[model samples]
Target: MTRIASYCIAASALFLLAPSAALAQEGEATPPPAPEGQAAAAAAPAAAPAQAAPAKAEPKEDLKDKPAPNSIYAEGLGAGLWYSINYERRVIDDLGVRVGFSYISIGATVSAGNSSSSASASLLTFPITASYLGVRSGKHALEVGGGVSVTYATAQASNSFGSSASGSGVGAYGSAMVGYRLHPVDGAGFNFRVGAMALIGPGFNVFGDDPTAFGVLPFGYISLGASF
Candidate 1:
């Protein structure tokens, strides 16, 4: 009976110690809880760098093609009956004024009964005009304008007998023109023009008795020059 009681006491003490050892081992195996802020930072991904916006581009200016503002040219059968040298200047973008000059002279000598006579005659023409240029397309444009012409004539005669005579006259006429023009758009270069013109004036008789009569005449001209 004594041996059986001692065995029971030892078995009970082992059962209590076994349960406490098992609880300590379980506690050591599990980790402690982390702080809330630290846990959130670890779980979330890093933010990407902020991106900059692209810059806007500005528009460029247009380079328009245009003719030069001044020109000098020789014209045939327009302002002058034969030819004239003309200079033109643009007061505005598309408006221009021109002035030109032309001249002609005649001379003759006559011998009659020992009394010789010599005579000379001269004509001077001045043309002044204002014109407008049309819209340019490439290197070409349409030109139109009108103006006036002034003519001065003089005659002188002297005989071997010492008799002398002289006369002079001034006349004015109206004129107009329409034509195509080719010129340099950017700089100095060759320029050309072709057009028709009309002149209204009094017809003058160089040899006949009647010196002035009303008349209208149609003419044409071709011009070549340099533009700047």
Candidate 2:
């Protein structure tokens, strides 16, 4: 009977010890699994920083693809009752080239030895011009150029005796001008120019009774024009 009691007590103690050993093993395994889950949670924040880096870099790259505004221009020429057309290309800053045409007229009255004579002339002036334009400010500008001015002129004269005289010739001209430019809308503009011009050189008479009489004359012109 004592042996049977000892056996029962020993069995109860072994069963309790076996349960404690199993619980210790379970505790150790649970700690390693918890550490792996925490490591994965920490790595999630690192992935967020990597995503944020690309977001910060994107705007700078996009701005690089954008284009800048154009500072150059092209304009056309228009003037008063005399109609003319021209083109100008902005080469650098405020410098450019100008080429165009103009129709001109002149008149004079002379008295020699008690004889009064009235004379009038008309011409078509073609100018192939090159100019240096200053920096444009507000609505004002200044320009100067030298070029060949070709003119075909016809003159008519009438004396107190009702007699008539007519002659035709060709001439050369040169000029300098100051102007105001107006910008009223996009792709369009206008200019007002006032200048002094000189016309000189000799040409043959296209229509006259005397072909052997060669003449040389020099004159000045006050000119105005507009541009677009």
* Model 2 misplaced regions, further than 4 Å: 1-8, 28-43, 46-124, 151-190, 197-221, 225-228
For residue 111, what is the lDDT in candidate 2? 86
State the lDDT at 2 in candidate 2: 100
> lDDT tens digits, residues 1-228, model 1?
899999999999999899899989988998677899999999999999999989888876433465678999999889877788899987876788989998989999999898899999998999998878866686788889889989999999999989999999998888889999887777788989899988877773333455576566778888999999
Residue 133, model 1: Cα distance from true site in angstroms: 1.8
Candidate 2 to native Cα RMSD, angstroms: 10.7
Residue 165, candidate 1: alpha-carbon lDDT:
98
- Candidate 2 lDDT at 33 equals 44
**Model 2 lowest lDDT segment of ten:** 64-73
Candidate 1 at 31: error in angstroms? 38
Predicted model with the maximum TM-score = 1
Residue-level error in angstroms, candidate 2, position 36: 12
